[model samples]
Target: MKGRFVTFEGIDGAGKSTHIGWYIERLRARGIDVVQTREPGGSALAEALRELLLAQRMPIETELLLMFAARRDHLERLIRPALAAGQWVICDRFTDSTYAYQGAGRGAPGERIAWLEAWVHGDLQPDRTYLFDLAPQLAAQRRAAVRTPDRFEREDTAFFERVRHGYQDRARADPSRFVVLDGEQAVSTLRVLLEEDIVTLCNT
Candidate 1:
């Protein structure tokens, strides 16, 4: 059987990360081979780029280019091979993040982002993307409670609001590929919903 690509997406502190491990365990219980990873940093070169991305403050164009550059390396070095080996791949973030963070949050041109996305990995897309939706102010509070903020995470609420809307718009445009979840929901509740979705995905 061919492997499925699953990705978790959301703005900082939207609680998507908390569910990935549990979701992987659930897949394992059913005997599925799974490879869990995250974007901006998956392969060695990608990881090095990730550090620069998270720390440096650069032009939106540079940031956008670097994002796709890391993605290309990640795909060539890790994501592609794992999927070819029939391992289900779960990534923390994907190109949708670029559309949200750079295209929307930073007011970068959408067409340019689309162009880069096509050039880098037009053939691949996550089979399912779980988007955790939340208000920017609430997400900001949650983020403040956690570890130090990264460059993107340090942006103001207005920026995050744009990012959130960007994610929602994409989800609306591609309903078949996105599953938007309320970030404020209880963990147990979200897991129950995710369990049903995963089972359905696995059976398909």
Candidate 2:
């Protein structure tokens, strides 16, 4: 049986991590066997790469490559296996990040990134993607309150604005598979929306 793969994506400080647990709990309460993981940091090697990528000083190209490298390891080691075993895999981020961060944010060749994704994982795409939509300035404020900003998070507002648009573009292009959620709302409100989506996904 093919298991469900759901990915959560958005610009940094979009409150995705803050809301992840709510979804996890809702799924487990319904007796679903869920495997929760985050990209660029799922497995040991991937986690190491995540640290390097998030550090304050790394070339943009290096960051992009590291993200992909972690993704390759994450898919082969954890994601695919969990899905094959009929587990619901909920990932924090996935290929979409590469497109937004590298392709749109850092101005990498879009075709090259597309080629890389296909080359690395032929048919491994998320069944559903939930994109938390919010302005970069608001997101930055939220980010500032929680923890120190990472390399990506430290980018100027203009850069983050581009990243937000990148996400929006991806979602718009694939509306059938992507759901945009208003991320500026209260966490309680977001939880309700997520629960609704979860019910629809599981029941279908």
Candidate 3:
């Protein structure tokens, strides 16, 4: 049997990170062959690129190119192989983040992004993408109390708002592939909501 591909997405402070470990543990408890990973990393080369992406200021085009560069390596060298071996891949972020951060947040041309996506990865997408939706202002507040903001995290609220909408637009366009979750709920409640869909996905 083919393995499942699931990705988690949200704004920086939307609380999605709080539940990733729980999902991994719960999915493994259910006897699913689960694997946890993240992008713009998963492979060594991608990880290095991730550092550059998060640490430096670059043009939107440069950002887009670098993201895809890391992603190509991640998908080809890591994600695809894992799935081919029947390991369910749970990723922290995926291409959706590009559409949100670069395309929407940075004002990259949508057509260009679409073209690059097709050229770099043909018909490859997560089976289910969990989007934790929340207002960017609230997300920023949550993030402020945590570690220092990185380059992307340092963006203004307006930038994050666009990123948020970008995620929503993608979700709206592909309803079948997304599970939109409200992020205001308590961590435990969020996990319960996620586990139900996650287990159902594994069973199917």
The lDDT per prediction is 0.94, 0.88, 0.91
Order of the predicted models by TM-score, top scorer first: 1, 3, 2
Error of 2 at 32 (Å): 0.4
Top candidate by TM-score? 1
Residues 94-175 of candidate 3 have per-residue lDDT tens digits of 9999999999999999999999999888768899999999999899999999879989899999999999999999999999
Candidate with maximal lDDT: 1
What's the lDDT for residue 110 in model 3? 92
- Alpha-carbon lDDT of model 2: 0.88
Candidates in order: C-alpha RMSD to true structure: 0.7, 1.2, 0.9
Q: For model 3, what is the error of residue 197's alpha carbon versus the real structure, in angstroms, after optimal superposition?
A: 0.3
How far out, in Å, is residue 112 in model 3? 0.7
In candidate 1, the residue pairs with backbone N, CA or C atoms under 3 Å apart (3 or more residues apart, or in different chains) clash, namely none
Query: Rank by lDDT, descending?
Result: 1, 3, 2
Candidate 1 structure quality by residue, lDDT tens digits, 1-204: 798999999999998889999999999999999999999989999999999999998998999999999999999999999999999999999999999999999999999999999999999999999999989899889888888898888899899999999999999999999999998999999999999998889878
Off by over 4 Å in 2: none
Cα miss at 64, model 2 (Å)? 2.2
- Residue 119 alpha-carbon offset, candidate 1, angstroms: 0.8
